[model samples]
Structure formats: C-alpha cells, structure tokens
Target: MNLYRIAKWVVSIIFYPLFRIHVIGKANVPKSGPVIICSNHISNFDPPVVGITSPRSIYFMAKGELFENPLLGKLLTSIQAFPVKRGMRDRNALRKGLQILKAGHTLGLFPEGTRSKTGELRKPLAGAGFFALRSNAAIVPCAIIGSYKPFRRLKVVYGEPIPMETIRESKTSPQDTANIIMEEIQKLLDLHK
Candidate 1:
C-alpha cells in the first residue's frame, strides 16, 4: 500500500480504539470529482480523524511549524500534507490548494484557521470559500463532535454539499462564501451535539 493508505491504516488501528471514533454521513462525500471538505478545528487529532474517516484521501495544509521537524515533515508530506504559514496570506499555499482542487482531488481545510481552544465554532478564514468559488468544487461541511479525551465517543459528521449556485447567487466575496460554509458547519454541530 502507498504511504497514505498505510498511515491511514495505522492511525485507524490506534485511534479507533483509543477514541471510539464514530463517522456519520460519509456518503455525503462525492465519490469522485473535485471536492473540498471544510471542518471546524478542535484539536490536533482533528485532521487525522477526518482523514481516516473520509471515503477518499484528503490533502491538508498543516501549520508551517509542524514541518520544522524534518522527520515529521517528511512523514506528513508522504501522506499528502503540506505546510502553510498561518496568520498571513501565503500565496504559494493558496496556489497549491487551488491546484489540488483543479486537479480534482479532495482537499481538507479547517475553515477556522486554528484549533478552537474552547471547542466552539470560530469565524472561518477566507481560504475555504476561495477554493470553492474559484474551482467551483463541491463543499462538504464536516463537524468533529465530542472531545479527544480517551475512550470518549468522538463523531465525525459529514454534511451535504453546499451548492455552488447557492453560494454564487448570494456570496460575492470569499468571506461571504466562508460565512455560508461556517453556517453549514454550525448546523452540523448543532444537529450532532
């Protein structure tokens, strides 16, 4: 198996039991075609949790700091994770994200740029909306419900795609589309919590 599959298998073996992870609405993810999976960030475990539960491999932009450690960086890269400088506009990272989407791959994004210390939904950054509008890809709002505490039931709920037409008709800017995405995420949170 490839690195992504191997890593996913290992993570599943370790995390499924430790966290009691539960995945719901995975069928909401498009089996093929370009797609963006936008989720609320809670803990460091969020990305891998989403990755393993997802029906397809997801390319993620991890914080640049994580890549400072060469070994971890190599491992992350091997599994399709790239580093992105947070708190600023990183053109290269943005370009990479668009390229992934234009190439019809699934890209995972934490709309809330950073993990929420309080586990509450935060305002989404503009990148997710930018990818959605620019690539016209399907946007799947996901929610990671429950804390990462051991033996606790953690849920990864995938919601229905937000139609491009709806976004285009109502959202004129990246932030506007981002707001809509957050709303969908919030709904999933509310429903699942």
Candidate 2:
C-alpha cells in the first residue's frame, strides 16, 4: 500500500480509543466525484479526529507553521496534509485545492481560517467560494459539535451535500456561497444541541 493509506490506517488505530466518535448524515457523502468538505475549527485536533472517520481519504490544508519541522512535515504529508500560509492570500493552497478536486478527490477546508476560541461558528472564508466555483465540485457541509468540550461525549456531524446547482440557482456571490455552506453546517450542529 502507498504511504498515504498506510498512515491513515495507523492513525485510525490510534484515534479509535481516544475519542467517543459519532457520525451523523455520513450517507450524504458521495461515493465518488469531486468533493469539498467545509467545517468549523474548534481545536487543533479536529483534523485528525474527522480524518480517521472520513468515508474517504481527504487532503487537508494546514497552516505553514505546522510544517516547520522536517520530521513533522513528512508525517503530515504522509497523511495528505500540505502547508499554506494563513495570511497574505495563499495561492499555493488554492492551486493545490483545485488540483485535488480536478483529480476527483476529497479536500477538507476549515473556513474560519483559525480555531474558534469561543466554540461558535464564525463566518467562512472566501477561499471556499473560490474553489467551489472554479472546480464546480459538490460541497459537503460538516459540523463537529462538542469538539471544544472537555472530556465529554464528542459529536462530529456531517450534513447533506449542497450541490453547486443550488448555489448557482440562488445566484450567490462566491463569498456568500461560502457563508451559505457554513450556515448549513451550523444548522446541523444546532440540531444536535
């Protein structure tokens, strides 16, 4: 097996016992085709938490600083995570994101751009809109409620897919499109609360 799948297996084994994992609306995930997963970021551990349970391997875009160390960089890449500068508009990240979708793979983006310190859903970033329009990929809205809770039964919910058709029909601006995506994710989290 390739390193990516190998690393996923190893990490999934490790995460299985660490958290009380639960998935909602997972069936909405398409079995194939391009997909973009938009989610709220509550903690640094959120990526790996969702990664282990994801229906397919998801390429994650992370902050550039997280890859400073050589060994850690290799490890992150093994898990299909690459670095992107947070500020100053990261073209590299955008380009890589489009490529993933073009190749018919899944890509996960934390629309808030940073962790939500207050555990509330912040407005999503514009990059989400850019990718959705450029790649014409189906967007999956996901929410991880209770991620900020300490030692509690954590819930990670995946909402239904929001097809590009819906966005286009609504005549949404690219930025507003990102907002709509996050709103759906928020609704799911609110449903469980």
Candidate 3:
C-alpha cells in the first residue's frame, strides 16, 4: 500500500475506537473527479478525523509551521498534506491547491483560517471559494460536531455537494462563495447537533 493509505489505516485503527468517531453522509462524496472538502476548524484532530472518514483520499492544505520540523514535515508530506502560510495570502500554496484540483484530485480545506477556541464557526478565508470557482470542483461541506474528548461520540458529517452551477449562477464573489459554503456547514451542524 502507499504511504498515505497505510497511514490512514493506522490512524483509523487508533482514532475510531479512541474517539468513538461516527461518520455520517459519507456517501455524499463523489467517487471520482476534482473535489474540495470544506469544513469548520475545531481542533487539531479535525484534519485526520475528516481525512480517514472521507471515502476518497484527500490532500490537505495545512499550516506552514507544521512543516518546519523535518521529521513532521516528511511525515505530513508522505500523507499528502501540503503547507500553507496562514494569515496573508500565499500565492504558492494557492497555486499548489489549484494544481491538485486541476489534476482531478480531492483537496481538504478548513475555511476558517484557524481553530476556534470556543468551538464556534468563525469567518472563513476566501481561499475555499476561490478554489471552487477557479477549478469548478464539487464543494462537499462537512461539519465536525463534537469535541475531541476521548471515548466521546465525535461525528464527522458530510453534507450534500454544493453544485458549482449554483455558485456560478448566483454570480457570487470568492468571499461570497465561502460564506455560502459556511452556511451549508452550519446547516449540517444544526441538523445533527
């Protein structure tokens, strides 16, 4: 098996039982083609939880600092996570993300630039929307509903795909598209909470 799949198997073996993770609407994910999975940031565990539960392998856009450590960087790269400079726009990271999409691969992103201290949804960065519009990929809105407390029921809910046509037809800007994506994620939260 490839490193990413092997790592995912190991993580699933460890996390699923420890966290009592529950995945809902996983079938909503497209089996193939370019996809952007946008979810709210709650904890550091969010990325792996979402990744393992996803039906398709996802290349995540992670913070640049996480790659500073050589060992950690190599591990992350092996698992298909790329570094992105947070706060200011990083054109290189954006280009990498676009390239991933253009190659018809799945990319995972947390719209909120950082994890929420209060576990509440924050204003999302426009990167998600920009990626969606630019690549015309299917946007699968996801919600991670529960804290990372061990043995607790932590759910990863994947909502229906937000059609690119819907966003394009609305003529929304990149930021607006991001806002719409958040709204969909919020709906999943409300429905499952």
lDDT of 2 by residue, 10-81 (tens): 876765555656677778878899988888899988888777767878999988998999999988888799
Model 1 worst lDDT window (10 residues): 163-172
If both were scored by lDDT, which would come out higher, candidate 1 or candidate 2?
1
lDDT by residue for model 3 over 55-98, one digit each (tens)?
A: 99999988899999999999999999999988888999999999
Candidate 3 structure lDDT: 0.93
Error of 2 at 192 (Å): 1.4
User: In model 3, which regions exceed 4 Å deviation?
Assistant: none
Rank by lDDT (best first): 1, 3, 2
* lDDT of residue 96 for candidate 3: 97
lDDT value, residue 30 of candidate 1 = 98
